[model samples]
Target: MAEDLNIHDADPVEEFLPVYGMVLADPALYHLAVSVGETLDRGDRWAGAIRRQLTHAVAAHLLGTYTRLKPAPETVRGGLAPWQLRRAQDRIRADLAQAIDLRAVSESCGLSVSHFARAFRQSTGIAPHSWLTGERIARAKVMMRRKDRTLADIALACGFADQSHFTRAFAKNQGTTPGRWRRLMEPEARHATMP
Candidate 1:
């Protein structure tokens, strides 16, 4: 039918018919088809435009449903390939003091930004930014062990904008300000340093 209309794009119904068989068994598809039929039967002035619009709508619906029903390929189901994950992680860790550009990281892994983000989340169970923030926090924790290192120094080293930013993020993640956290860790630091 699309061919008769000189449409070069593959017809959604024809593409999925072999796998899904007739769509009439699906109530939504059945209702849509019935409605389109009735609209055409009425032979109103807007029939031509309505038919075109509804036909595309039906095709889009079928395509969406087909994608939802289809299982992702096994290799991609678990998310990014091992090499991609390693590359993305290494890139993100290469310089914690610098702002992370997700676009650059995704490109390094030969993926689009959205795809890389989704796959990264699937592989690590967290968004890339969240992972980066966690890493920053972890690094800040280590730096806090050195009493000589001021919160401002640690914040700059961990890619935070300033002491305030570090304090906010630390509080959000650890439920305490960086100063309070350092105080809390001071005892541990003392114990660990004692021979």
Candidate 2:
């Protein structure tokens, strides 16, 4: 039907059928019928227009049948409940400086690792590992404000194994090296202290 009617995303038919009953409640058909009458009165290309409208009118029914025939995909299990999500986030935040075990994390939520991972992604719109990394980066940014701390110290404190690992992760997350980010923050820090 799409090929027959030349329906494109930019120029597509909008569904005007809201009611479902024994008869099709097609407001689109009514609108098109009115348009055809108006075009006929003006002596325009009413024939061609009516043909296109008829194609859409037929295609709508065909698509409705297609929808009815197609089997729906089985949805994954429900997302972590709100309390479960909060508990997971708290656990992640508390253990941000330590190595995370997926099994352990999932167990805390009373779920299998696969289910927990899927539900975590569903709740947060990010994979668990990615969310963890982002949290680690956020922690690093807060520690970065202190000029006394070395990058190596900050790295280990924020759950990264080494300075190089920290640098790569921080660069990817912040779009700059940690040292550069610190340097940029210095002026802002200095200004904040003044009256």
Candidate 3:
């Protein structure tokens, strides 16, 4: 359908159909669509004016999709009984800096420690200590990206015992040292335009 339209011919009408189709297909085009529309409209081309309108219309459609895709906060309302586990998870997440007792977490869920340990593992696919470690590691990754903090500070903040512990844990989960991981995360000059 696109080739039959000979959109590459650059006739305003020909350009309109394919460009309009693209706008309809992927409306999250950042500013590219708007800029194209403005540039075309400024040229005083009839097709350009039509394109601007079509672009805006398509943009509106994409906006709706984008808003819908905004990830909703995980909620416990109207869900399975186990959804209350979210509260327990949230509590644990909040105090990631402190030592979490599996017994206490189970009590929060109103389950016996042993039962909760098993069920929580079944629900989340990992033991509570493992899950807690993963969450702390994830938080540490975020901290490592900023220039202000030292590795020692990040380890302390994320509740690890010390630098050696943090390094070993980070290596186990990420398969690389923290320094190397941070280096890899740095942008190459050629890809500077990326988000």
Candidate 4:
């Protein structure tokens, strides 16, 4: 298996099939086969339901890989190490409300900014700016719990330049305005109490 291809990734088969030529792994699609073997070994004659579940899991796990195993691209190789990833995430969390400086992050990791950006993308599958935006949105979601907090205040706290910017970004990511999301939260509480 290619180093970049996680069996649990969204599309493992497609990921592996591309690098099938360069890879040294056998083409038997062993993961699914092993799953079936283990499932049958339970030896319960009445295990039909369990067998069905195991089959479904195996199918989902081997999706796309059976026919077209592939190799990972050279450029995608060598992502940040575990510690570096933790450090980078920590730094991003620390400055969630501020503009992240790529140069500063790279310097902190002892890597050039461009190198850091490439490795970060390969490792995380998203750009640093995109990740920062996602983090901001997540933070906004948490802060939205305070029903009394104005959207503008939440926006500023989450590092949006202003209320309009925050609303636009929030709407873009969340498929609704902050006010609407907040309203949805309150109804959940009402439903919980009723139940």
Better of 3 and 4 by TM-score: 4
- Which pairs clash in the backbone of model 3? none
lDDT of 3 by residue, 1-195 (tens): 222322121222211211211344453564556656567636567767777667755554444343211212233333214454676677678887888877777777777777777776665556778778877877887788687999999999999999889999989876778887766665464257657
Candidate 1, 127-195: lDDT as tens digits: 888878867887887778687888999999999999999899888876668887666654555567879
Candidate order by lDDT, decreasing, is 1, 2, 4, 3
Name the lDDT value of residue 88 in candidate 4.
83
List runs of model 3 lying over 4 Å from the truth.
Answer: 1-80, 189-195
lDDT winner between candidates 3 and 4: 4
The CA lDDT of each predicted structure is 0.73, 0.70, 0.63, 0.69
lDDT for model 1: 0.73
Regions of model 4 farther than 4 Å from truth: 1-76, 189-195
Task: Output the number of the lDDT-best candidate.
Answer: 1
Off by over 4 Å in 1: 1-78, 188-195
